[model samples]
Target: MRARNKPWADDYLKEHDEVVVQAPFDNKNKWQDFFGNDQPIHVEIGTGKGQFIVGMAEQFPEVNFIGIEVAKSIIVSAVQKSLDSGQKNIRLINVNAEDLRDLFGENEIDKIYLNFSDPWPKSRHEKRRLTYHTFLEQYQHVLKHDGEIVFKTDNRGLFEYSLVSFSKFGMELDEVLLDLHAYEDPKNVMTEYEEKFSAKGQSIHRCRAHFPHRN
Candidate 1:
């Protein structure tokens, strides 16, 4: 069944100023203007309600975070949540992840987070997956050398596909955990989806992939 369109998206359209980019893919190199300094910038491609990005921004004040969500209504809630939490280092863009290269310059991003991305189940729809080679190529254009993509998902098939994709693209994988909760690390930040799924006794699959040097 097709997902119903979110109605609250219209309300967010009225408060456009709160959103940093009205059309991100069109202005690829303009991101530097939004952040005056060259401090490391991290991006979250699909920030479903903004919990993870906001929490990370608050936790790491020294870094800047940019979240891109195609759903305007959800992004509005994320922006409002960030504002209410008194966070100053985060921004949201309403756009498709495919257009990331058009919005960011070469080697401009320091890190990327792909938390609980949509699992396009059909084999024919595999290209639509965020971890697909096409999207990874786009990410490579914007990510700095050694920049890493931290991905977490509850879908094992998708995780396996992503691992192969990353390796085929010459990216290195590390910190691969089939069950995130088993890890004793405090740096783990759970997203809204992760929290809900983990509560239901689901194991979260996660991994970190980095671009190899082009020597």
Candidate 2:
């Protein structure tokens, strides 16, 4: 789906923005200072409309949350939702996921979440997939030693490709669930996409991947 351009999206973001961080970021490993605490930090890349991450922040007060998204209009919706939810443990960043290495230092993030990410299904566009080897290496640079990546998607092809990619990248697959809702965890928070897909009887695939410290 193409992103709809909202001329007033910036204004809406600014008005509702206690959470969105404007670019030119130099935080590099100083995220604890930004959140005014030394709590463990977790980031959700491509946090569409903010439902999952915001719900996470509310549920896990001891952990800090960051939502990274590139689209202005979509991110603005997330910001507004967070504001309405009155969640303080989360922040939003309007930058492409590829720039994460520059913004965060190694070991800065304790965990990362990828929820219903774009599959980039074409073979020619394989590198564009979030779980592609190149992108996994980027994720490694900022995640702490033993840090884990939790990924979920309704796309069967993407899930299978990711499982292979993670093994090839030497990341351990600690947990895998081909049918998430059927696994029945009450603590599970549904993203807008997850809810939508599940309602249509689409099975959600999820996994927890851990990257060992580089030698």
The candidate maximizing lDDT is 2
lDDT of predicted model 1: 0.83
* Per-model TM values vs. the true structure: 0.91, 0.96
lDDT of 2 by residue, 95-149 (tens): 8767578888988999999999999889999988999988898889989997999
lDDT by candidate, in order shown: 0.83, 0.89
Q: Give one digit per residue, the lDDT tens place, for model 1 in 1-215.
A: 33357687766655655555666666576566666666699999888788999989888989988998887657777877887878768878877666677779998899999999888999999889999988988898899898999999999999999999999998899879999898855888889899999999999999998998765
Clashes within 3 Å, all models in order: 2, 0
Which pairs of residues collide in candidate 2?
none
RMSD (Å) of each candidate, 1 decimal: 2.1, 1.2
The candidate maximizing TM-score is: 2
lDDT for residue 190 in candidate 2, whole number 0-100: 96
Give the CA lDDT, 0 to 100, for residue 53 in model 2.
92
Model 2 misplaced regions, further than 4 Å: none
